[model samples]
Target: MAKRRITQETFDDAVRENMEEFEMNPEDALRDAVEQFESQGVDLTCIVKAVPAVSSDDKQEEQTHEVLKALDSLRIGKDSAAVADVTADMKCFTEQCSVGFAQRYLAAQKDAYPTILSYCKKSVEEQDSVLTALSALAALTDGQPDLLDAEGQQFLLDVLKKHQADSSVTCVAICVVRHCCLKHEQNRQDLVKGGLLPLLTRAITQHSGCAELIKQASSALRVMTFDDDVRVTFGNAHEHAKMIVLEHNGLKILIDSATAHPNNTSVLSELCATLARLAVRNEFCQDICDLGGLKLIMTLLADSYESAVVYNNNNKELVRQVLSAIRAIAGNDDVKDAVVSAGGVELIVIAMNRHMTNPTVCEQGCACLSVLALRKPNNCKAIMENGGAFAAVQAMKAHSDAINVQKQACMLLRNLVARMHNYSQPILEMGAEVLIAQAVQTHQDCGDVGKAALRDLGCQVELRELWTGKHGSLAN
Candidate 1:
């Protein structure tokens, strides 16, 4: 007889003839066939055609058939090494397929998930790559979101707690727990009660080599600790922010990091800004001030070249963040004086001049200047004497075009004139009367500054005469 072609008929005949021998281990039999096909360069189309068709009564077999079909579609050619290359892709595809099957199977069988979970636990130990097994398990949990019944959830929690220290597993486990927590408030409480917080804290401290993992864990911890329910569960965890600031000497770290790696400007800026906001509370400001946060902020302002390049394209946010931090620090008199002594005023003035066309920065700079002026009346007077008042009044007069900038600049001017009526003298002397008269003329509907200018005019003897022009006519 002619040598039999290794078609589906021959393959099925060969399996049937040895059915009793391999009936106890069909998976092993399939693996052997797949390996043989690899070693002998057998035709997969014939082998695939030979595999017995799954019956409708066997849903698991049906899913396996679908998975095999998916695997076949990914086949590049009849090559064997192609099998190994497709392993990861096949695993991912089957993992997703199993999730939908598991959900439907659980609902149909009523207790299928727990049974499969138990089998998974027993077999996971013998698996060559536990990561793959764990990934499948995580997928099951995600798919049958409700499948982690109390016992199943406890089983998962136990696994997580047992391997919580395993850096490789911790990241995956944290992700699984994060997903679970997001599903419900009760799940969040369960995670905290199950000791996820301490696990995350330890991971952050121990996984120093894994920057991405540490960042993710830190982000998760931030979310959990700030969660309304978790907050009450882990009472006063927010207070730990202050402790981190103090213990880490976060200000110095931020300044050094930002200075050293200007590319990481946003990270450092956010850190400094967050610390500054936290420090604004009465209990923390003094400690922040004592920790040299004020000095660091002033240093940032003084060393403009360092931050300037990073902020050249987007100075508005950078300036606002820095100014906010400075303002927080400047709420302390000693810090304000330190800022001025560190040349903060001049740097701010330069930035203001550079960003004059950028109304938001102009407004922020004007506001900072206003703060400095309020803090140092002599500084306010000197600013007017040195032509700072003209720039401010010009910005204020142009408020109609950019209302926010105009409003801030006007408020600054109003504040300056209120603090030191003498400051208005130089402003009025520099044709501020013309600007104010024009603002009154153009923005008769302007509320705050319109009223403020009227009030300032009522206070100024020369401006009052200038407005009346010595004969009760508007200033020329």
Candidate 2:
């Protein structure tokens, strides 16, 4: 061969000639081009551009079909590198392709789902990576109800069943099932029947990795428990809640973890919220109250970190759940005294003041305060003495925009006036009359507030009747 000096033109012409041979295997061509660029120090981008593009309409469709087939095969393969590359390609294609291309790519690869599931089951160390890919795949098919048919649903359930004991796998499996359950009621049912609750209960006590896995597992359980089909499935959730509180020392662990990892707001919030739900009606409330659950929650609510904002939201929810728990346990005068001594009222007042803009927080804080107020008349008096009445009344008038907040505030006001009529004097001094007037005027627009304000007003009038023997006139 004559001495042919290599130039950019020569390299470009070589790549173009190879690319023009349509009979050549595309993967082989790509591999050869990559190797040539590596040897010649040529920019791969230039080589890629120089390659001939499939031009004929039929050839273009065929090339597209071939790529899809390759993706489907790679998705099913055991080769991690190949699977990762194909997954990346699929993700890019989904983002850049036409709707028709996306639909075909998703639908035409239904046969490969089993392989995907197998990869999920086999990739022990890379479980999170695989799960991330599975999540994306599930999202693609989420809008297509029939994309994940009975077979696909069954495959997911199989993975859950197989890896229920592996914490990492269980975490990913939960997310996969959660994605599948978004629009499919049947998949939701399948997840429950596949023993999700037992797995979650086990994970709550057993999963020993970073707290994130536990939190994610707990969150998944929470989501599953909300489904009507799965709600009844966790028939033992109440019993389990009691077990968590009494047997596992769950309240103590949650408090410690929340305090230690205050920066991991999501984990801390989930753990606390889960504990609160568990403590709902269990006799364990007394144990938890004795173990400082209330104090821990209050401390978190008072913290100034961003996590505190999360804790504030979750604390409001916990307060609602723990209200019944508080009533059941704090019925004892001594326990009631401890709640006050622990600064529960002051914390409630602070949460009310700080999170007034969050209606749920205001409602839950007010509800908890009402419980404390009813149980301990002295504590209620302390609240009034400390300007809580003004905050409560402010929440009632301004926060009336939220029905729950209005209801909770009205209920607290009613309890205050009913149990400690003496506090009503201070309440009136704090513009209680004006606030109540505003509430009555706007009550009709809010459901819970309207009903609650009417009930509270009637109760106050009824008390006046009982005291003075006059139905319509006040003793004054």
Candidate 3:
């Protein structure tokens, strides 16, 4: 990526080198750096103030400091009269008038947070001015969400709810809430209580045409779904990404978004992830199947795999979620038949080969095959015909270090061999026994893998014995 035109004051020269070294763009690098700094209690507000005076190398040293507090503060020139004028006429929030005053007040005035929240409430109708205030609030409170007291957090959420119609205002509002909720447990709780999830989902569905707005809303929804409670809530609505999203027919909205913006890979990738998360529960399986979930996900799977090797704009994230969601959906008997009939098993094996080195996809692919293999009497035969058994064993051998792959590989083979048919020959040709023995030895610490590996070996041995008993064994 080319260099982003950051203001010289806010831009660190060495950050460019760090970006190259980390193989990330400017935005991701800065976000990561800020997160690392925040974790160590570093007062970024002070660092921003001290950047001009400090050397780059010395500043680099400061990044690793064990202790950081607001020991330095930005100097301010705003008088009380200017602040009073802005308070009286909300339009004065332009340029540095509002931003500068906010910086000064945050640094010097103890009552800065309360006063700013009240000021924002005054001109909430001024979308542009409210955005400016939110920006200032983010700068002041990114490293310390506590500064955005209960009232401030509520005000920010309210800002999002009120301006859901105005994409620009809601975009900034979403950014403000995301910043506040960055690693702040209390703030996330406040958001959940403030009805952030449903409101954001509504905004996403209502504003599907607005790319930037959908991007921000989906990003925030993804962040909030990190909580287990939130995941369960999302899993409740049949096929909906989250519980809150279902309130506005979020699933249909997702399908509509996918249909309308087929080329928007970013939004689609995020949507895939949300779907994967919601597919965790068994109740959601039939709903997803009925809604053409298998067919939709299969398209993404093929596209992600083909795009990964051939295109620069491949969405690996979409691949990961497609695999995971398939694993969840395939767990159900009905969805399993639907997936197999749609040639989903073959696509899964292809994806595993395509992303052999991707541990996440490899693991999920093996698990999905296991579900497919055990789905019905015909499934094992179908998997063997599609060469899924060999593909699974190959994945296990290739990604031996991935415990999940090992466990799921053992599972798929076990399910296939339970029928004790043509699966054994293909599996053994792929040296399934050797890999299972290795898993048993290598993953002794991982009880699930080791135990499954042992059980599979026993099943294969019994199968060989039965084959020999049925027909005279000829070494030839």
The TM-scores of all predictions, comma-separated, are: 0.48, 0.61, 0.67
In model 2, what is the error at residue 62, expressed in angstroms? Answer: 12
By lDDT, the candidates rank as: 3, 2, 1
lDDT of 1 by residue, 1-476 (tens): 33323644455554544454667355555566656655675655324423454545764653233434433443432233333344474455445445454333322233334433543354334333344445544554553344555665575566656665577666665655554554345565565566555666566555645544554454444444334443244443355344344544433443343444344434435545655555535546655667666666666555554546544643455566676676666666666566666677777777666556667767767767766666577666655654566677666655546655655565667667776776666666766656555555566444557557547644432223335336565655
In Å, residue 126's CA in model 3 sits off its true spot by 3.1
Candidate 3 structure quality by residue, lDDT tens digits, 1-476? 43223222243444544576877776776667666555655545433222223324564643311111121111121223223335323222222223442333334234445545554676587776676556555554544555767778778878887888888788777866766665565667777767777777777777878877776776666556454333234322232244644455555555566665666777777676666656656666666777766778888877775655653334655677788878877778888888888888888888777777777777888788888878376877778888787787778777889877788888888787766655566677778878877786688654555455446545443212324454555665
Strongest candidate by lDDT: 3
Alpha-carbon shift of residue 127 in model 2 (angstroms): 4.4
TM-score of 2: 0.61
For all the candidates, what are their Cα RMSDs to the real structure?
18.3, 15.3, 11.9
lDDT of candidates 1 onward, in order: 0.54, 0.56, 0.63
lDDT of 2 by residue, 1-476 (tens): 33223433455455545667745555556567657666765544312222334435676432323234444555645456433545665454334222343333333344444454445445434555555455544444533433566666665666666666666666656655555555455655565555555555565555544576667665654444343343243444454455545555566655555554555545756765565565555355566666777665555555533234454545455444443334444545566677677766776677677667767667776777776777567887877766666777888766756766666677677677666666656666766665665665676554344344445444342112326555675555
* TM-score head-to-head 1 vs 3, winner: 3
Residue 459 lDDT in candidate 1: 43
Winner on TM-score (2 vs 3): 3
Off by over 4 Å in 3: 1-123, 133-149, 176-189, 228-242, 305-313, 419-422, 459-476
Clashing residue pairs in candidate 1 are none
Model 1 gets an lDDT of 0.54
